[model samples]
Target: MWSGDELDLDAYLARIGYDIERDGELAPDLRTLTALHRAHASAIPFENLDVALGRPIPLDLKSLQAKLVERRRGGYCYEQNSLLAAALERIGFHVAGRGARNRSRGAALPPVTHALLVVTVEGEQWLADVGFGWQGPLEPVPLRDGVRVEQDGWTFGIGVEDDGIHVLRSLRATGWMDVYAFSPQTYQPGDFTVLNHYSSSHPQSRFLGQVVAQRPGMDVRRSLLRETLSLVRADGSVEERIVTADELAATLEAEFGIELDAEERAGLERVHAAGV
Candidate 1:
């Protein structure tokens, strides 16, 4: 059960472009679940701008709602998945908060650095994640072994190993690659606070010294780093280029829908301060 008076379901639904509803309750079915997942992926971008800005990442629900929903900004895994978990709980879905280590960042043993949700609806479990950086699944994938789900020409598969699940993504020419692995035994609610601190401040954290952004639009999916911009076309072809530092703000505003305010613009300079 959700721990608040009530979640602003209406606002959340609208934020993600979910219109259909069931009187008072959000249905816990595959259609509704997938719609919500897809809408969120298309709407809210996955970004780590706040970390670069030296902003304190509050794990509270109110802060998440304000930043992600009201302010129309995006965040990394902890913020994104937390907001989704709350909404799913209010909608009567059984939600479990889980953490993972990004293999892309170089998988280490006993990892705990990412956030995701395992939602049980109608006795079936689905992996729901809205904050995974580029190549993340756009739809909720079944938590079953050997099943492949496609999202925007990319494919994802889950394999059960050693009491946990390993998420794999198709690499076009290289075949499947390990994305991340997670198990309940390794994840604790307390882990997020510790991980959040490290991810937000530690110099070695990938988010600390870079500007990363991603979001999928009607015709294409856009992604960016400090200087690189990549667009995945509908035909599965990718166009990539290197943009100047001066062009980053405009690109964020125009492509990712994040218009950096004066404070945010000032924060851009701090990315260089990190790792020093």
Candidate 2:
């Protein structure tokens, strides 16, 4: 029996631009691994438009799968991580869903603001992430603590801490900075819900006040519409332009693959008018 609230496997895969065999058997091997990488890279784009639109980001498998994979939506950490967990399990991969804290500042780390997958293949475990916006990993790497793995123009590694928490980071010009941390504890949907609500509702939350959206490809495309709209490329180059309501809608669709309704368009106009 399937978990009542679990996300659909086939639909989720299709949402990410992948077609699976309706009746053919899926084997656990490198072929499966490669397919997953391709789907993650191509199908679901990392984005934050829902938060800016004042819509509650859903963490349940079905809703998240619908938003990201069905309606062709984009989401933050919780939504993307949750759906990926469901898809990996449905395909017979041994997986673990782990919560992570963003401790880049060397503090006690924040709440469960991020998520990643741990899978055991051939007696080895690897960390897999496809939801992080611009700074996410492109492929799964060995889960060896404190070992560096080269990725797309970056180096990433995980560090095992004394408090039983694992720290993840990317190698920068200065040094290694903490990204997030996690443990072996399993995550329930409600955990993510609390964090999502806080991020969307809190007055201090950045998403509630700004228009931030990003799409990843050969380069990272980030657009921030506050005071003035700034479109930035991967190499730190930027293009500044003034946008009307129609132009904003067109930019959302053209840049982030997000289609807004009338209400959403009106809300976006309000944001633009407020100069935030």
Candidate 3:
């Protein structure tokens, strides 16, 4: 594991509302790793606001830290996982960046658009992802078959596919859904640059106007689409509403803790318009 020469470990820990000293169990154990994962998933959010507003999403470390950590913003898979991997490395954890495809059971697999972390702690490999918009496991789960992990009302498991294990999540409608599939090959920063650009700029991309944001919580999971705002309780019950255009910014701030700047606010307006 490498140190954070350019990355600010303290600021990142503070941003995620995590105190390393309080954990008292460092050295990359499963307990501390789970703490870090839960804290990050709850505090920070998964958002595509920049894509909605037609802004560039850069993959550089400084740009990611400045936007997510300093500016108090959230990002999609590429940006969010990149920041988490850096912070994990700073804390002396063995983190490797891995890419996964948003896949289905029998359909042809799409490109590798999702970025996640394979962290090795105490000689055990754990899958760590904080940016999946849909709710999933709150803590790091072993990358093995039949390992069930539950967070709030959501249930997740790693399925042993022929190629490798696939991350799966369960809900009321679909019993289990395959979110993505990944291999052990570590991906480089350059691989994500192309994916981020395509995800952000492609006219037909889902991120263009299909607003998706989430802030996972212990008791409730708050999420937002272009117009709908959902509050899912711990009992698997959901209460949701269609947020008006005028209320989008405030909903984002109050519910998801995302305070948008002028550009982002205007960008949200554009996103809502295109949908209508």
Candidate 4:
């Protein structure tokens, strides 16, 4: 199942700032699921810095723990969700993987490059994903079609198409916007490895040459793509500005909570100076 036994559950709990003594014991229940999901989403950011630095993205549990939990760094989909899946599984939840197409980009059909999790609690399924940068749900969304849930001020819903694909949508100012869609077919860890290879290394992959980091919050969402940093509020207002190489590291740390070492900071600055 997601190599749950190998994960250091206590370390992960601490990383996400979840306190068992204060909150409660970890159990395979909805309350525990939602608490962990929200905490993980808020604590770990979503970033593709390693890919931008031309580093290999490893999906092993040990590597994920070392890079994300121990290093206090962020990662893109596979790394984020894989770590989450492991933690949830270790807590006795039934977690399964699913591959999704990126519909947020536009009408053009993108390949299935995103990885998410479906966890079953007391025979009910929940769509649990902490990887989808700014547009992701803060907590697990019910897998039922037409079910809508609001977290703080943001609203998200699930819809089923004629083909039986479940589409996750967010209620934007314009209207309901599709975030991403996935089928009923469950994916495996090996399947995510294949997708991760393409996303981390393929020349056409958007993560390859640019710096991308995102943090989602209740009232505001921040996104840094290459040199541009954009902040979008729940009311549809957006403020965007270009970030120079000199400000990249500080911006990441200040806005996304991503701390980079001297080498990473120097390398990313070079890339930012060159532009995407």
Assess each prediction's global lDDT (C-alpha) against the native: 0.76, 0.67, 0.79, 0.93
Candidate ranking under lDDT, highest first, comes to 4, 3, 1, 2
Per-model TM-score on C-alpha atoms: 0.88, 0.79, 0.90, 0.98
What local lDDT does model 1 show for residue 33?
75
Model 2 collision count: 1
lDDT of 3 at 96: 80
The reply for model 3, stretches above 4 Å from the true place, is: 1-3, 103-109, 171-174
lDDT of 3 at 164: 71
Residues 77-105 of candidate 1: C-alpha lDDT, one tens digit per residue = 88887777777777667778787766654
lDDT of 1: 0.76
Top candidate when judged by TM-score against the true structure = 4
Instruction: Pick out the ten consecutive residues of candidate 3 with the lowest summed lDDT.
Output: 165-174
The 10-residue segment with the lowest total lDDT in model 2: 1-10
Using lDDT as the measure, the top candidate is 4
What is the full ranking by TM-score, best candidate first?
4, 3, 1, 2
What tens-digit string does per-residue lDDT give for candidate 2 at 24-68? 345555456546754675556666667877777777666776677
Lowest lDDT block of 10, candidate 1: 267-276
Which pairs of residues clash in candidate 3, taking residues 3 or more apart in a chain or in different chains?
Answer: none
Quote the lDDT for 251 in model 4: 99
